[model samples]
Target: MKANQKATILLIYTGGTIGMIKDADTGALKAFNFKKLIKGIPELKLLDCNIETVSFEKPIDSSNMQISDWQKTAEIIEKNYTNFDGFVVLHGSDTMSYSASALSFMFENLNKPIVFTGSQLPIGDLRTDAKENLITAIQIASLQEKGKPVIQEVSLYFEYKLYRGNRTTKISAEHFNAFTSPNFPELVESGVHLNVNNEVLLKENVSKKLKVNTNFDDNVFILKLFPGINKTILHTLLHTPNLKGVVLETYGSGNAPMENWFIDEIESAIKRGIHIINVTQCSGGTVLMGAYETSTRLKEIGLISGKNITTEAAITKLMYLLGQNVANSVFKTIFETSLRGEMND
Candidate 1:
């Protein structure tokens, strides 16, 4: 690598469909050495970038993903904070949103690309989509103009679409287009030409230094309001011992039942200093806590609106923000506000 060379990209493979291969001995799927990745994709040599791989010591299935794994990914990024211009995470699609959302909140004031990508099929298959997904992700991570990153936010690149990581949710199991941003537009779409919707991107904090937050409070719960829900179960969840925060899934426009017991329970939780975030159950709308009389009680009881955020984003954002030991009064304000380009301003 010369002093005046192209941008460097760090490809972090944290276990996913993209790295799987047929083990000759066992005939079982296993993750292969990333050193052989280029041999399978010769087109990578045509790109004007220096790409490097950093695979996990022990590849984990998406089902085995843990909070500790998130910490490991963060530490890696922190260690290479200045060496690489951007990062591409080849991850299991099952938990990609959670990982992406966590990273979005963890890396405050970040100005580099962190694109997460995975395929529906294993790379060893003849018709595997992994090669296209991985190749383009590398290209996107290395994208720059005027000597600055064109994509300065965490994103998910899959099935020819690039979405804001924190704002997306997986909505399919068998389809190549598995994820979507319920309320936001696609950030970038891959085609004959890569068209970037710059207007939808999060503006980088040009004045603030990059701040990485490692601490995360995992003492959080989610309760989706539905008809016929038992009040006992509801109280148990809200009244859990030493609960810190909650992500409440409410009806359209943040409407909840006006039942006296429900209202009273919410009020009591607020009195106990538990942050209650009211997010809509619907995929594509913002929660308006006071829009209707039905939701007035929620607002009066101090429920916060999670405007246009997916369930995956809400839970992780709450964990990230709550871990910072911020005051209770601040949690409501911060949860509803757009952080890490997760929601609209």
Candidate 2:
């Protein structure tokens, strides 16, 4: 890399509020053509990077996103990984955390930045956060340290803060600040200057070749625990056909009822080869199993501890590992471990 060499960035628009505009006569929001992206954001021309854009022909809202969509996004990145210096994914904020987490697992040994961003208001709105988000996300992607990509992992940029993708969750619907990584500090922050906490940024793995994994098993479900959950209802979910994994969103610090029936239900499921992961319901804090009597049974029954992992990451990780056909003996250990900077130590 040379000073005069311009970095090439690939901008992928998968459709969301960021790609919508109000029709003048009809006044209804519709997808904007990516061909007019440069014209719409004239300031992009001033940037040092050469930009190329691709889009989904039928822009599906974030709510409609599926595993196939995640596969498609990964495919695009895989196909163009060599050509682009960095990548930016324009996605709807509603499910951005899930998408980002999924991609983090899909792209193994990623050495380039994949910044995911979207807006609460449409890009054409009078008051929009789209431009700022888009601009900074690209800048973060194009960042180079000693001629190498600075941020070398999947990340989400929203409301002037950049967070590790798998660590973030959408916490609001109406606010510009819609995403937060409650359990993790931000990788970067934008204010008077783009303040990057470089020490925490994921270091690039230059030795490993980039691998795109799209074989995700969706035979997993989230069972969020609540007070007074019926035994019958719990049994029914635990017996869902073809269920290979479960993200059990447990109470504080991964504690759950110490009742014999509850512990037996989980033990039965685990014995039947169903992976039971205990994740804390709270936004922050690690799951310290056996820290209390309520959680000791879960540990004794061999439930995997999702320590400080977001539910989005836990579920996606379950699917990824299951798709890989990990052995049952090692599944619990792998699920509890951080595969892609998705969880803390």
For 1-345, candidate 1 gives per-residue lDDT tens digits of: 244569899999999888898776887898878987788678889877988889999988876887789889988988997899889998999999998999899988889999999988888777888988988888888888777778888999999999999988988889988888888888889999889999888878768888889788888988888998777988899888889889999999899889899998889988998888888889789888778999988988788888888888989988888889888867788777787777776
Please, what is the TM-score per model? 0.96, 0.98
Quantify all predictions' global Cα lDDT against the true fold: 0.87, 0.92
Model 2: per-residue Cα lDDT over 1-345, one tens digit each:
565678889999998999999898988999988999999999889888999999987889999999999999999999999998899999999999999999999989999999999999989889999999999999889988677888899999999999999999999998999999989899999999889998888875699898888999999999999999988999999999999999999999999988889888899999999998999999888899999999988998899999999999999999999998999988888877788888887
Q: Please name the candidate that would achieve the greatest lDDT relative to the true structure.
A: 2
Off by over 4 Å in 1: 1-4, 24-27
Q: How well does candidate 2 score on lDDT at residue 242?
A: 97
Worst 10 residues of 1 by lDDT: 1-10
Residue 236 of model 1: what lDDT? 90
